[model samples]
Target: MSNLDIFVGETSGTAMLILLGGGVVAGVVLKRSKAFGAGWVAISLGWGFAVMVGAYLSAPKSAASLNPAVTLGLAIQGGIKWSDVPLYIGSEILGAMIGAFLVWVAYLGQFSAFLTDPQVLAQQPAEEGLVDQKSAPNAGPVLGVFSTGPEVRNYWQNLLTEIIATFVLVIAILTQGLNQNGDGLGPIGILITSFVVVAIGLSLGGPTGYAINPARDLGPRIVHALLPLRNKGGSDWSYAWVPVLGPLAGAALAGGFYQLAFA
Candidate 1:
């Protein structure tokens, strides 16, 4: 595929991935949405469907690699040329940001109401310094709609959780007998990939929301920082690197192992 095709495909696919995936979080977490408090099963399935839809739509043009971790893993395994990796990663990030922005727009009213609800404010701790100092403004609870956070707040453990979850993800992708493009699994493989995602969420998502993709987490986190929602809170920059680095590290490990074991 041409560079333009790659850019457009990745961007559109990743955008859709984040839109439906992040939209589920907003629907479940926001105060006024019909799906509010729908819980983690809903989130896991929603994200699985989101992956299926995005990959189906974007696979033709650029193989629909919506995750930078996927892109890097494929490159490391020689499924993709090194020269094309940057384009794929950039497009995924841009698409993720766009998808996140759309989620804010789609849930505008819910966010407004949630931010202003007295109970929400009342729930926030009176003291700020007690929390992660880097996340001073992140004391607000609603940020989880746009990004992942650790339930336990242990950096090493949180990082390991992301790594292990992502390692499972990338390894599955490599062994799935899907198309070689690394942008997507084919039709049947798409279904398999979605199921894999659901399994990861059901089995391993407890700790840090299973941020197995760098673009998926960072793009929305960047949007969370940029949008002007009232009481929206800090982007939790302190915890951001864990998701990004852990996924990448996991992907590298998967690629190296694939070379040694399967390639």
Candidate 2:
């Protein structure tokens, strides 16, 4: 599935959830950059598009969920606060979910309008499959002929992956956020983050689908349940806890590590 592929079939507009969920911080960081301002930060579309384009390169055939795992880790490490955590995450969830839904409806309309066009229908199966893989990022498509995806199967393994992946993501963020770029740290910080996400998605996205965030997985999972996906039964409650629990564990570990480094 190309970057645009999984954009289809959003029963609850989950695509917005995907974009804003991840872009919220990315945008703020950009605004704080020397070249940008709070106005630039408010340019939600710009940041979203920039990050999406960067991530899209790695995921021409995927949804690029990016996972809230990254956010949870940074928050715990003191890069963000507990009080503000809810809104950012809530925005992330709502934005991505909404975007997904809109993309789905848009594609559905296109498909219905161009029913005979094989290419239009060609992307359908992939996006449909993406809705299923929302809990885990970097997990391969569930639509391929040899697609053997684990449906919330292993708790510890999934949890472990979230921890490890978040570690990689958080460490990179710490380095970038603290580093002083030419003019300021903001631009490099974002570029650093986008790069970390891309690198993680490419290198370690194979196992447990790289959920990395409780909210990213669960919020979208909720959207999946609320939405009316075809033949989309079994919301996979068994593995829901993995993303939530694993990311928090990873974030706590990051906090410990950051404190150790600073102290």
lDDT of 1 by residue, 207-228 (tens): 7888899999999889988999
Query: Which lDDT tens digits does candidate 2 get at residues 1-263?
Result: 22133233121223443444333322222212242233322333343343545344323322222345544555655554455455445545654555444433434433233334444334433321132445434332211101112434566776788788777766666555432312112544655666565566556555654555564566555655565444334456666676677776776777678778852
Q: What are the lDDT figures for the candidates, one per model?
A: 0.83, 0.46
Compute the lDDT of residue 101 as modeled in candidate 2: 48
Candidate 1: deviation at residue 229, Å?
A: 0.4
Best by lDDT: 1
TM-score of 2: 0.58
TM-score of each: 0.93, 0.58
